[model samples]
Target: MKYFVTVQATQADYEAMEGTESPGPPRWSREELLAMVNFMGELNNELAASGELLDAQGFTAPAEARFVTASPGTEPVITDRPYAAADVQPAGYWLLECVDLDRVTEIAARITQCPTPPGSPEHPVVIRPIGEAPAP
Candidate 1:
């Protein structure tokens, strides 16, 4: 089964991220970051060897992004940054094609160990199965 694991963040959490002008503190030491990446790489390699992981990538922060919104009978509004009502933003995500939910949960836990800004513990990695496409 294919699953999408979304890493969610609160508004305050989003605001606290490192921007281009002001890179924040390192969540992990250089060595630690390397180790984490290596670990994840190993996991991915293993999964690929077993023919499980379809694809995976670590995303850049949203500060380097644009936001767009649309409403009925109106032109789409494009903005420089994400617009949220005080409590919602997607921090990152991963797509995993696994054999079962148990495997997906294990992968999600591993991905959650990726670093985050200080003082934010509620940012959780959520995993959900992708449904089959509707018949024509």
Candidate 2:
């Protein structure tokens, strides 16, 4: 089966990207961010070499986000990001082909261990199986 693993951050966490307390810049140090990126790259490389990584990517900040409601008769309400009211949003995702959900969950758990801001608690990684195309 193929699974999508999503990394999520709460609004608070997203806000912290620019600073938590009265701040001027991101809280994470350059070295810290670099290390995390390197670790992630290594993991991705490992998965790719094993041919299990179908796709993976990190998303831009919500500041660039735009939401459109597609409900009928509801004038397409469009909202740009800096979504201060959002409870949670995806930060990154990985598509993996695996034999079982257990393995997928284990991978998600490991990904959650990637270093986050200092003093930050464990964030979340959502995993779900992708729908397969019907056999013709």
Per-residue C-alpha lDDT of model 1 across residues 1-136, encoded as one tens digit per residue = 8998787754444344423112333233456546656777787788778777777765554555677799998999988785442445566566778889998898778777765445445557788799999999
Q: What is the C-alpha RMSD of each candidate to the true structure, in Å?
A: 4.4, 3.2
Q: Which one is best on lDDT?
A: 2
Local distance difference test, each candidate: 0.65, 0.77
What lDDT is reached at residue 64 by model 2? 68
**Largest TM-score belongs to which candidate?**
2
Candidate 1 local accuracy as lDDT?
A: 0.65
Q: What is candidate 2's lDDT per residue for 41-111, written digit by digit as tens?
A: 99899889988899999887766678888688777889874666345678889999988999888888789
What's each prediction's clash count?
0, 0
